[model samples]
Target: MYPQRDVRVRHARDLAFSLLTPEDAFELLAFEIAERAWFEQHIEARREQFYTPHGMSQHIIECLALNAQGRMSPLLIRHKGVIIGRANLHDIDQNSARVGYRLAENACGQGIAHKALNHLMKEARCIYGLDTLTATVSVDNKASQRVLEKAKFTVVDKLPTYSQVVDQRLGCVVYQCALREKVECP
Candidate 1:
């Protein structure tokens, strides 16, 4: 469905957003391995297979299939051509989609996550003709919650015992954003 392996979506300062492709396997693997522990702090850990080369290849193929089916968009966030994070629009339908994203440990606190999310919102709104987007944030992840709020997402509900990480249970907040041509941000 895609003419090129890595089609650029848009750029946010030095950060580039692009459709994920098979060629991204190596760098993406390195990024995932380096940030595994850091990511697990705010979210549940991924399966061990995800850190393997073969596993990543399979994952990318599945993601591209969904992208081709027009049910999802898997994006890689890069800085200076290096993978630093990811943002994805999943479960896309006629009027809504679920959005999720993560940034590397070193990339945190740099406003990159929020910027990437906003760009994803644009894609969902304009490109996909979506009317709403939803995201779930772990209750303990205050930073992400704040970003969602700043992006105009409203809390609609909460999921109890949303995730099990190691020995702890983390509840999650469900947020929904209504798409608008103009997004007011401070």
Candidate 2:
């Protein structure tokens, strides 16, 4: 289950990350469509239907369902009362999860991503009890690689053809971070 409270803090700027709710569907949809080109530069394009109101609403339903099943956490990032991005914990298991995030083109280069990631890291460890977090970034996306590195994630593997980005295969680097020290009983 997601924490009942939203997280707000002052780092480079005042930013809040909250659990995705059904009410956020349209606004988040607008943000997604507006940044489609920029997003596609680093990640795969979504199906055409996903750009529609009903389709985006359905996507949120699926995300919330997984969250209810304790399988994932999908979050929305807001700045100044505007939806600016998203951060997600995918493939969550007992002690680990894969992290991913995206920012609006206007939200780039302001340390927002780094701070947002660090906040998500805390949520992963403290709220979800995950001890390890991993992220896969395209080798060509230096900005994202740097953000992960600055968040203390280390590169663990490199896949030559990991994912699709705008119809092309993209090579990716997998990075991992230990959220907490795992102790063993003697």
Which candidate has the highest lDDT of all?
A: 1
Kindly report which residue stretches of model 2 are placed more than 4 angstroms away from their true locations once superposed.
Answer: 1-11, 181-186
Question: What digit string (tens of lDDT, one per residue) describes model 2 on residues 20-135?
Answer: 99999878788888887888888988999998899999999999999998888999988877777899988999999999999887778778888778877887888888999999
- Give residue 21's lDDT in candidate 1 (0 to 100): 92
- Identify the runs in model 1 with alpha carbons over 4 angstroms from their true place: 1-12, 181-186
TM-scores for every predicted model: 0.90, 0.89
Model 1's number of clashes is 0
Cα lDDT tens digits, model 1, 28-91, are 8887887778888888888999889999999999999999999999999988787889999999
Task: Indicate the TM-score of model 1.
Answer: 0.90
